[model samples]
Target: MSVTFNDFNLQTDLLEGIKSMGYKQATPIQAQAIPHILESKDLIACAQTGTGKTAAFLVPTLSRIAEGRFDFTSTLILVPTRELAKQIDDQVEGLSYFTGATSIAIYGGNNAQNWDQQKHALTSGADIIVATPGRLIAHMQMGYVKLDQLKYLILDEADKMLDMGFMDDLMKIINQLPKERQTLLFSATMPPKIREFARKILQQPEEISLSISKPAANIDQQIYLVYDQQKLKLLQHILKDVEVQTMILFTSRKSAVNEIVRALQKMGFEADGISSDRTQDERESILQRFRNKQLQVLVATDVMSRGIDVDNISHVLNFDVPQDAEDYVHRIGRTARAGTKGMAITFVNERDQERLVKIEKLIERELPKITLPEAIGESPVYDPAGNRAKFSRDKGGSGGGRGGNRSGGPRREGGSGSGDRNRSSKSRGERPAHVTAGAPATEQAPRVAGAPSTATGEAQKKKKRRKKPFKPKNAEGAGNSTPPAPAPAAE
Candidate 1:
């Protein structure tokens, strides 16, 4: 089943670059799509992340362009995210290094002056232009980019572009390209909308579908049902285990990414966050550090899940559950790359129950749940207004009051102290106790005027302790033991 690049009749220069990278045989997607693309036929490829999709298209497209048969903006590759655009640009550049084919990547968040210089370079015209749909449209409208000579079009992460509300922009860019050009649409998941979009754009395209429902067979999926408060503790425990080396932690929101990064750092993990808020340069630096193995963990939103092709990621952690099922696939897909085995762990809270069910349906298999630490209780409920009444229901008509009487006549302080023990105990753990019908009593400290609550304070302290460098017991014992006598030298 092994097929070499030479077997595909690729240009000598491109093959040289491929060999220089120490790759010989084509991956499944590369094996299937390269031949079709080499034939100058339109294609719709359904390949998941980490399946060598980049090479599948880049190799064939570069070979076609190097034939010197096309003119005008000969090839255009559009991606949903700026990160992905940069990734595609890098891949094409690397593969075309030996060839004289020129390529440029333009995306949002860059200064117009820089783009102006790049656009001028493209005036003689680029062999290929990898871009984000928004930036590409802007360039096309401003007359900086020309597609009349465009012979090939690529839409990568088509589902993601649609999710980001880029259907209009993608359609606009496609409309501007030549009608006689070849089109390739690659997506991890194909929804009805993506199929409809493909129907409108592609003309009799050949189809290549890989595993679209399940995670890579090489990846081990596990879920941990933990209370929201203890999730961070569990993450710290898992990170401390020797098996985990490098990881990409996915959060649902930009804000959550920031918080997770800070919390993880406080716990002594070399972690960082990347989101739309970061500057392009900063984002690139983070990715570079991650690739160099200088960073142990990268906390990111779903934006970094796709198009990031780091090879040594040992694990993927879902700190915040993904809202979209497709994103769940992509998040875990960061690991188990290139036929390597990896692990993905998700923290499922009570609030995430419904979404987790939906994700299971999408992937068409139930994710096995991991046994959580006994300290971690049932998943904590999330309330925007800090009101527990919506989640709590009383069994008896005690009518103590809806939402539990907050005015339970000021709780008595345990310690024997004068001068208003209520105020003094308030400094201690004197928060309102959550009393359910027959459940064991648990006391939680009330919110202080200016200090963090007792629970938050305890969690923070534990996090700090976890981050400290761990010294092995053997090493400690050896240091305390007496030195042995030297042995006689051998003859």
Candidate 2:
């Protein structure tokens, strides 16, 4: 007894828009949610990314708005990120093309002109307003934005908003909304916090759970256990070996995003980093290029995990394991979308072993371990205890060609020492025909732009180990010079 969009009894305009968008069949979330949403009932839906949750709410919301509710801002959709706000606004525009329902997207990270435009939209009362929690709150605080006639309050990616520490802001925004509004809370994972938040906001909501907290089954998952220093080389090798059409690489840190993107670009891969550091315009441009397949790879933090909905993504790379298992699901869910077979590759270092274990537990299956190409270098042995075998730094240039360092130790190209030492940006060209394990130690490679500026303390400590001072027994007989207690042990 499967259902289609035609079964939902949506307004003619919305149905036409859905057809034009080529949405024939309803996703499980969409089918279950649309009926409840059209009934003006509160809903709490637990669905994964790529599950068509956005359209599930938008279609019905738009239909209700199209019923001559254009006099005031009737529907207020709160999302977690600026990117998501824009994404929803785009969908709203397409879905309401026939209905002529008006809407505006309000988000931060732009200048006064953007703010003024948003203020105008908010005060003038569009049919709908798609906004991030923070930005909407900012407008609410100013007392110009009005939602008195609001009939619907939708929280898309509610879990993500809470994760970003917007609980208080959400409360503020919710308190300002009319108490009689229809509330909908959609999330990927429903932990205690989400249940609590839903109870506070949603009124006896009908619940829907579709593949909750699980990634798409079509995604082929693989893991590579490598040392942190070797990740770049291994990534390069993988890109060369695999036919990656367009990929999103997720790292845990903003700095890592910049570093990985710079390194990849130096290697001649079309790559760019997107983070909070980038201006809104820059991020939009980067996203546009990525969507057009002009940018081959995008290195980003978890910010892009939930916001991006690009199709035909060939691969998703977890450059660093995410702290939360739910985040792991979202990161990988970027690929293998809409029944497309995509690949997810994770780079797991020794420290990320526990996080990796958590992800496996959440997904309820162990990802297959990938064998690194010989040219990339020797992969680290998997240690369940998270203890890595200690290897001395190779005096030679960062292990050239990934066969590993001259002494079989970790190698850095410019020099193996510390300080946000930038790896030399100078192209290493193609890997040597025959990598010499006995290559002579070379001078430190010059730092490339965006390379780590702080030297890791461990490397510096290894350089200055003082030999045990021999206490002179005949200090009274010979010119006895006290060793001054070994220089009082350097701090």
Candidate 3:
């Protein structure tokens, strides 16, 4: 027997709100969580981002508030990022429209007037307050914000908050709230740390876990193994050929984000960069432009990995492999949302091969390898175990073998015929005529049958030059450093 919102025994006004939002059947998380929450039971739910957990908790809480129960700020929801706080707050408004319950989103992106508005809402309570722990702690320190009448405390994306280093802030916020309140904890995954935190916060709570953590089935994942120097050129080649209506490119460093954005712009693509160094207002503006289609590509760091919820992201490109496997899931999760199919492309360099293997293990499948365009030259082979033998490049392709030709081709500008004869002898595994055991270090040696050549040997002189690392113009724009520690703002 399938259950609907009506089976949950929600208030008529709340049911009407649900209908207005076009939700007829409850998702598994909603059906299981709503009832337990309405019965005033604390819950610890393990569900992924798109599993409808937000409505599962919000609908029941709003219904309880509509019953005219004792209320000042009836519910408090703590989230990890400012963007998530606003997202949940927007959902709260939509669901509570028919019930006349008011709510506010508290985060750090605004000026004095915004602070005053939040102060007013806190003083004269709203039915629900959705906030980021760091921002809320800033307000609470002023001693004017009130949560004494709080009845429900919800921690949405609890694991994400911990990942963002909000444990101290979360504990401070919890201590300020009344102990008798109902506590609902929702996380996408159940790591050991999350379990320990839940044990401390939730008391005899009902636990419900949905499908395990994995990228949605609709995402089309692709992997490319290319040398670091070839990455930018390959990206440009792909961008020229692929359908990139609106996409996000994730890099491991903020400096890379800036560099990619600049390079993309030079290639005549509309793109912008976002990092922690940007003030809250600047970040919001960049996001707004992205949402409005004013920006075609957004290059960002892991800071935007979790909270961003743009629905039309046609693709996600990982310019550098993330160090953690779980972060790979979150980065690609930004796309292929709401059951829409999307593409995720990852660039793996020789140094990052091990990280790629970890991602493959986590996702439980080897991603399909993509062949680089011919213009990009030879690429590294995928070696998950770090033991795969390197292949010899075909001489017909571009680039020289050794000193005979600088460009790796048959012809050299000023080389004598001896260089050409030496090349042939080297290929044949016979020592060059002028070479001897005690020859100068620069003297060339021939490859013996299947033995490694100078190019592959320790005596190899010419190596692929690595590009200079990108540096931010100023101290504030350093490589993905967390925004300065949170502090109270002046009203």
Candidate 4:
């Protein structure tokens, strides 16, 4: 049986705040975690996305703080991303409206006025602090934000922070926290790494594990076996076929974000994109628009997968398959939130068939694959095990469209932008694109002191070559000598 906020016997004013948010019933995670946190016991919680885990920790912690607390920053909520920090801070403000639990979100990315605000929040103190690990560490290094009197320490999205390699920062922050404080650890997936890490910081914590590796049942998942070039065309056809109020299109490559947004916009949809490359302020503005239903579609990379907290998302379209099977869950979890049904569609190309197979195995069921539209051309065969050479790399389409130029390599927009580089190489769990084929191991020179770097030497040779463009080697009446050839990257 599900419980309501009234059953928690929370403070009257605190219960008023919870009721004001229209949260009548407690989610399973909330039911399981709230009581333990109220009892001041260390807890480790595992729940899927969109399951009210944030409220699970926040409500009980706030109730405790409201039971009679001074102004010493009683609660510390540590998250992995600045967006999530801001999200929790917003929720804290809402849930603590009647109880008067003040909060400030501290994150990095600006140096001037932003720093001053963070410094003020740190020095003046608030009832709660929500911060990203790195930014909190930066403030902590300045020796102003103290937590000796903190009553509760919460690690939200603990797994993501660990995956982001914040173990050292987490430990450093934990070391400074009061040894007698209540600690709560919550994560979407309860991987073994999380349990191991929990053992280090949590003291005999009560364990609450819900469905961890699977997406919510409210999501109607579907798959499409598509050739790479057919993705945009099929996307356009589907949008024209259905009435999509709002959709989030996820791509593995940040470089593809802008192109997908551009293509969709050209098709007469109000579209925009957000990636790690965008400034935090820009991303916040775009997300605010998206949440307000001003944009019909939002193109993004995995950076927004777990960070986004918007609800009523009509659909989630995967422009490209995610490399991580777990990421597939979070990407699709953006929709079908809070018991509302939503659709999730994925595009699987020849190169990502192996990843698709792994996703099915992780989810413990094969997704229903839809046939490709005939007008878009034939899709590659979906034979992950026996079809290594079944599909040709160059068989998607004419590689020409307003969507993007697919005939050549990634559209070299000309500059040092990250979009111009091979993003697939830098994504987690994938090997760099510069394999032995791209760089011959036999040609690697030994590293010695004063050795000229490739880019620097290339720059010097380019200057020498440009000094006399009209001259050739030993040419008469042009120049005394010829310049060396340009390097490959310089070209």
Clashes of each: 3, 11, 3, 0
Candidate achieving the largest lDDT: 4
* lDDT (10s digit) by residue, model 4, range 285-333: 9999999999999887764566687778889999877756777887887
lDDT of 3 by residue, 1-491 (tens): 77899998888988888999999988899989998999999999998776688999999999999997555788899887666787798888889888999999987542555667787798888899998775676677668788987899999988776755567668878988898989999998788999999988888999999855678789999898887667778898888878888899986554456768888999887899776556557877898899999999998765555567676788999986764677788778878777889999999866567777878888898788888878898877666454222211323353333221222322211122222322211211111212333322111222233322333322232222323455676867577665444322211
Clashing pairs in 3: 399-408, 400-407, 400-408
Model 1 scores a C-alpha lDDT of 0.69
Better of 2 and 4 by lDDT: 4
Candidate 2 residue runs with Cα over 4 Å from true position: 213-218, 337-340, 371-381, 384-491
Off by over 4 Å in 4: 213-220, 336-341, 386-491
lDDT of 4: 0.74
User: TM-score for each prediction?
Assistant: 0.73, 0.76, 0.73, 0.77
lDDT of 3: 0.72
lDDT-wise, the better of 1 and 4 is 4
lDDT at 68 for candidate 4?
Answer: 66
Q: Every model's Cα RMSD, please?
A: 21.1, 14.7, 19.7, 9.3
Candidate 2 weakest lDDT stretch, 10 residues: 424-433
Ranked by lDDT from best down, the candidates are 4, 2, 3, 1
Q: Candidate 1 — which pairs collide? A: 267-467, 431-445, 431-446
